[model samples]
Target: MDRARLAGFLRARREALQPEDVGLPRGPRRRTGGLRREEVAALSGMSADYYSRIEQQRGPHPSEQMLAALARGLRLSLAERDHLFQLGGFPVPRHAVRADHVNPGMMRILDRLQDTPAQVVNHLGETLAQTAPAVALLGDETRHSGLARSAHYRWFTDPQARTPVPAEDHATRSRLMAAHLHAAYTRDGRGSRAAVIVDALLATSAEFAELWREHPVQSAYCPPKRLRHPEVGALELHCQVLVDPDQSQTLMVFTAAPGTESDEKLRLLAVIGAQRV
Candidate 1:
C-alpha cells in the first residue's frame, strides 16, 4: 500500500468535512473546524485508535473492507472511493453492480436523519447503513452476513426476521418480499447475487419456492406498515422512500402520523435510544 499517500488522502478528506456536513454538532469548546479523528471513526464504525494509527502511517495495510468503510465514513465520491482503494493496493470497486457503496449524497441525507428511523438499502435488500433511531426501530439490519444480509432471504429463512411485523401482515409481507426479490433477479439476471439468493431460497424455503412459481410483481408504492415492537407495543407507520438516480439504492424513512399513539411511541423510542428494555 502507498502508506504516505493514503494517510495524506485520508487526513485531507477528514479535515475537509465540517461537523454540520455529517450531522454532527459544533460545540462551543470546539477548536478546529474539521471533524475530529474520533468523530470520523465513530461515523466509520471503527475505533478511534485504529483510525489514528492509519493517519500516523504506522498501521498494517488496510483491507478492502476497511477502505470501503473509510470511503463511506468520509462520504467520498465514487472517484475518490476508487482512489482510496487504489492507495490501499486494491482494485477499484465495481460500484455499478455492487450496490454496497452508498452514494455520498444519500449518506449525507442519512446523517441528517439521526433522530428519524431511517436506513439505506440496496436493490437486493442489503442494508448499507442505518441511523440510531432506525436501529431502535429495526434492530440493526446491517449486522447480518452472507445470504442473510438480504432481508428477503432472512424473511423466509429466519423466523425471527419477521418479529417486528404483526402476524396478520406476515403473508402479505412475504409476498412483497418475494416479489421484490423476483424484480431484482430479473434485473440482475442469472449468476448475479440476486440470482444466488434466489437459488438458495429456492432450495431451502418452501414458502419462497411456492411464491416464485406464482410470478409476483412488486408495486411502485410502499404502503403503510404495522409493527409490533416488544417494548412499545403496536405501531402503525408510513414508510417514505427516496430512490437514488441509479435506482440501485433506496433511503427508507419510517414515520407516524402527528398526534397519534404511534407518533408518541416513536418519541418514546427516541428516549429509549436503541436500548432494549
Candidate 2:
C-alpha cells in the first residue's frame, strides 16, 4: 500500500537502533542518528553501498539471508522482522489464499481430530472448518462459529468471551492470531480477502489495530492457553497448529500434555462435547 512509508519505516527503525543495541562497539564522534549504514552492511554481510541503496529505496530485491541479517542488526521484534520482509519484497513464510476452496481431505482431517479440539483455519485465522470439541474449547455455543468472529468480534465485543478465558491469555492469543493474520495479508500482495478481514478487525478493535500496525509476524503453532470454561472451571490447554503443505489452510489442534490435570479436564470436555454432538 504505502511503499514509501514502508521504506521510511524500515530506514527509521534501522537508524533508531544503537550500535551497542546490536552488539557493535560505539565508535568515536558519530554524527548520524543510529548505527551507520556501513555498520549495518557489515553486520548484514552486504556492501555499504548496497545497504545505502536499500535505505534510499534504490536497491534491488533483498534475499532472505539479507533480511534476516537486517532484522538481527535492527534488533527487530517478531512483528518488525515480518514488516521488513514484506517491505523487501521477500515471500513472507506462511499460508496464502488459493483460488480453490478448502479440500474435502482437509475437512476429513478436522473431523478425525474430534477428540483433540481441532479446527481448520486459513492463514488469516478464519475458521474454515472446526470440530465440535474445538468450538466447545472456545466456549462457542453455535455450531457455525468462525475463528475470525471468535477472535475479532466476540473477544472484543462480548463479555462472555473474556469470561471463559483469563484476561492476559486472551490478549496474548489475540495478538498472536493478529500477527499470523498480518503475515498472511502481507504475503498475499495486500489485496486479498484476508487483508480485508484484517482491515475490518482493525476498524472494529483498537487493540487489533495497534498490533496490526506494529506488523508482527509469528508462526506460533503450539502455544499454551489458559481457559476458564463455564462448565469446566480453570484449565490450561496446549495448542498445536499444523500447516497444510498442499493447501492454504492450518489445522489447529488443542491438546493437554499427558498425565496432567489439564489432560483429565480436556478428556471430560471431550465427553460432554460428544454428548452434545
Candidate 3:
C-alpha cells in the first residue's frame, strides 16, 4: 500500500480543518495547517505524543473508540474516516467479526437450502460456503469467489455492472458493505488480506473511495434489494442474513416471498439453473 501517500493524505486532511470544525479555540499566531497534534489529542481524548505518532505513521494500532474520536475531531468525511482507519491498520469500525472459522453445522445449513439462494459470509463478507442457487445468483458456477471480490466491488467500480440499481441506493449499499467489512477487519485484528482488499477496491473505484469516507455500519440482518437483470428487467428481493449463534459465520438467504412476481421470476431462474446443470 501507499504508506507515504496515505500519510500525506492524512496530514493534508488534518491541516484543512479549522479549529471550529472540531470545537477547538483558534490560537493566535498559528502558522501550521489544520489543528495541532495537541489540539487533536485533546479533542480525541488521546495524548499528544500518540496523536503525533499516528500523524507520522509510526504509531501502534488504534482502538475503535479512539479512531471514532479522531474521526470526529478531524471532521473527517466518511471516506476520509475509512482512509484513516486503513492507514492506522485498524479495520473500519462497523459490524465486527469473531475470529472462528465456519463449522460443519453451518455448512450443512447451506447445503439444505438447495432451491433458495443461500451462502455463508464472514464479517468481512467473504463467501465461505454457498448453495447452488447462490452461485447461480452471482452468475458463477463455482462458489470459490469471495463476496468482497464479487458484485459488491463491481457495482461501484464498473458502470456496466452498476446499471441494475438506482445510483443513490447503489452508492449507499457500497458504503454500507465496505463499512461492514471494515468492522470485520477490526474484529479480526486487521489482517493483511483485509488490507489488500480495501486497497485494491480504493485503487479501482473513486466511488468506493468516496463512500468509504462515510464510515457506514452494517449489521447481519434482512434487507430488501432492488436488482435489474439484463433479461429480467427489475426485481426486488428480500435478503435474510442469520449469524450463527455459536460461530462467526453469517448465513445469507435471498427469497422472493410467495404470490409475488419476484417469486415467479425466481422460479424461472431455478428452472434455468436446472437446465444449465
Candidate 4:
C-alpha cells in the first residue's frame, strides 16, 4: 500500500467533512475545522486509535472491508471509493446490480433521521445501515451473514425472522418476500446474487419453492406495516421508502399517525434505543 498517499487522502477527506454535514452538533467550544478522529472512527465502526494509526501511517495495511467502512464513514463518492481501494493496494470493487455501497446522499439523509426508525437496505434485502430507533423496531438486521443476510432467505428459513411481525401476518409477509425476491431475480438474471438466493431457497425452503411456482411480483406500493415490540406492544406504522436508482438501495423510514398510541410507542422506542427488545 502507498501509506503516505493513502494517509494524505484520508486526512484530506476527513478534513473536508464538518459536523453539520454528518448530522453532528458543533459544540460552542469546538475548534476543529472538521470531525474528530474519534468521530470518524465511531462513524466507521472502528476504534479511534485504529483510525489514528492509519492517518499517522504507522498501522498495518487496512483490509478491503476497512477501506469500505472508511469510504462510507467519510461519505466518499463511487469514484473516491475506487480511489481508496486502489491506494490500499486492492482492486476496485465491481460496480454491478447488487450495489452494497450506500450512497453518500442517502447516508446524509439517514444521519438526519437518528430519532426515526429508518434503515438502508439493498435490493437483495440485505441491510447496510440502521438508525438506533430502527434497531429498536426491527432488531439489528445487518448482523446476519451469507444467505441469511437476505430477508427473503430468512423469512422462509429462519423462524426468528418473523418475530417482529404478528403470527397472523406470516402468510401474507411470506408472499410479499417471495414477490420482492422474484422482482430482484428478474432484474438480475442468472449467476447474480438474487439468483443465488433463489437457487438456495428453492433447494432448501419448501415454502419458498412453492411460492416460486406461483410467480408473485411486488406491487409498486408498499402497504402499512404492523409490528409487535416486546416493550411497546402492537404498533401499526407506515413505511416511507426513498429509492436510490443508481445504487439499487432503498431508505425506509417508519412513522405512525399523529396523536395515536403507535406514535407514542415509537417515541418510547427511541428512548429505549438499540437495547434488544
For residues 38-102, write the lDDT of model 2, one tens digit per residue.
88787555799988877677757667767766765555655576677787676564423231234
Worst 10 residues of 4 by lDDT: 93-102
Per residue, candidate 3 scores C-alpha lDDT tens digits across 129-152 of 556666556554222345334435
Clashes of each: 0, 1, 7, 0
List candidate 4 stretches off by more than 4 Å: none
The segments of candidate 3 whose C-alpha lies over 4 angstroms from its true place after superposition are 1-102, 141-152, 155-163, 245-247, 274-277
CA lDDT of each candidate? 0.92, 0.66, 0.64, 0.92
Model 2 pairs whose backbones collide? 79-216
Show model 2 residue runs off by greater than 4 Å.
1-100, 139-159, 274-277
RMSD of 1: 1.2
lDDT of 4 by residue, 54-170 (tens): 999998899998999999999999999999999999998986632778899999999999999999999999999999899988889988999999999998888988898989999
Give TM per candidate: 0.97, 0.55, 0.55, 0.97
lDDT (tens digit, per residue) of candidate 1 on 44-88: 889999999999999788888888899989999888989999999
Model 4, residue 125: distance off in Å is 0.2
lDDT of 4 at 79: 91
